[model samples]
Target: MDVLTTQTLSGVQTSIEIAGTVAFALSGVMEAARKKLDAVGVCAVASVAAFGGGTLRDVLLDRRPLFWIEQSWYLWSVLGLCIAAMVLMRAKHFKPTEKSMQWPDALGLGLFAASGTQIALGLQMPALIAVLMGVITATFGGVLRDIVCNEIPTAFHDHHPYAVCAFAGGWVVVVLHYLGFYPNAVVAIGAATVTLLRLAALQFEWRLPTWKIED
Candidate 1:
């Protein structure tokens, strides 16, 4: 790859990562509104939901200058969005339904899934491990958000193929990378795969079977 091409690819990857952060932040804000949290609590939850997974990923991978630290703009952006969301929630007629955050959650999941896989691959991690990292990167933030909000994490309980979507998208990224596709193309395809699969699962009520030990 040309030097300029590598720089361009890095810029694109950064954009995807930022977009994912924003999506998760919005999801957190919606959840906080549904819970009727105060401004401070909402901001706290939104920041965690926006940065928790990536922070964990960076720690696990021993990537220094953690992404949010490197891009402080993400924090500022989340703060601005959360402030706006709080104001919106103050409207007497405002009410967020149960399904309000689905789109942003799904989009964030896909983008983070691909981003995680790409980073792990860059580190020469095993394929399966890379995929797992991708899934963690995608879903862990939501887990933290739910935990903080005193709700069971949807990824663990929903059984709606949430992590499965991330897993599949991670593999898509891995396969594309092995096939010598451009990084941007790989990220796009993988994210799209996850996002579309999640939306379809929601639309069709697709689910993973539950385990039952009792007869």
Candidate 2:
């Protein structure tokens, strides 16, 4: 891709990044509240869930200033979002369940996967590596969030095709880009594909067969 194309893709990636941040932050807030954590714990978990994956990806790619460091407003935004979510969840009649996180988590997974894939592609990374980065960007945040909350990481133990959703969607982005789709269109299609696939997995309880150790 030319400089113009790369810049265009970067713009799309920024939007996807922001969207994924909000989505993942919401999931973190819900989980924190469900665990009866205080505001401080909520903010901590939410920030990690919002930025962990991207932060790791940036480190791997040796991207300078880090994403949140470059965009300090992102931190403030996530803080405000967590506060608002806490207020909403504190409602007596409003109970946030683990199930409630599925939709937003799926959305985050898709967007981050697309953005990560596009970022790697722009850097001229190999397709498989790009896809791996995408999956990491999409699911690693939730992994950290669960661990911080003293819970089993749902992405690991749920057997619900969480990272698989991101992997499949990453390929969609790669295919679309190679097929000459517009930059925005590629991200949109990839994100949507991942989100829809994740939702379907939840709806159908899709699972990867686990190795059974003989008792």
Candidate 3:
């Protein structure tokens, strides 16, 4: 890749990461509020939700410094977002609900899926590995967040196509990149595809096949 192309890809990835971080942080904040956690707990949950998946991805990929560590502002930004969300929700007498949390979670899932797949592809990983990385980056943070909040991870139990959406979107990213689409456009389209698919699934009550173990 040319220097210009590399710079553009990096910029796109950074933008996607920022948006995904904020979305996941908001989801975490809402979940924490639903759990009636204190301010400190809220911030801690938000930080894990914002950083956990990416941290895992970096570790697996052997990327230095981790993205959040290299971009320290992410930590401060998530903290500020948690504080602001808590204060605003309180002032407005808003009750955080499981439904409200899903919106930001879906958006974050899509963004992370696209960004993660792109990053892995840039590293010359195999297409399957890249897609798996994207799925992991998109879903693992929510798993961590739910575990912290003492609940089953939605991705595993919801019977809705959560990581499935991310996996499909990752393939979209891979295909677009392989077809030589513009980096930014590939990311945007990939993210939108995943987000829209997830929202649609939620709206239409889509279901995955589950074992019908009789009690």
| Best candidate according to TM-score | 1
Deviation (Å) of 42 in candidate 3: 1.1
Q: Look at candidate 1 and give me any clashing residue pairs.
A: none
Q: Tell me the spans in candidate 3 whose CA falls farther than 4 Å from its real position.
A: 1-6, 9-17, 96-102
How do the residues 154-198 of candidate 1 rate in per-residue lDDT, one tens digit apiece?
Answer: 889877799999999999999998999987788789989999999
Candidate 3 global lDDT: 0.85
Go through the candidates in order and give the clash count of each: 0, 0, 0
Clashes of 1: 0
Which ranges of candidate 2 are over 4 A from the true structure? 1-19, 91-93, 97-100
Cα RMSD to the true fold for all candidates: 2.7, 2.8, 2.7
lDDT of 3 at 166: 97
- Kindly list the per-residue Cα lDDT of model 3 for residues 35-137, writing each as its tens digit: 9999999999898888888888989999888877876888889888888888888799765566876776777888888888988998899999999999989
Clashing pairs in 3: none
Model 1 stretches astray by more than 4 angstroms: 1-6, 9-19, 95-100
TM-score of each: 0.88, 0.86, 0.87
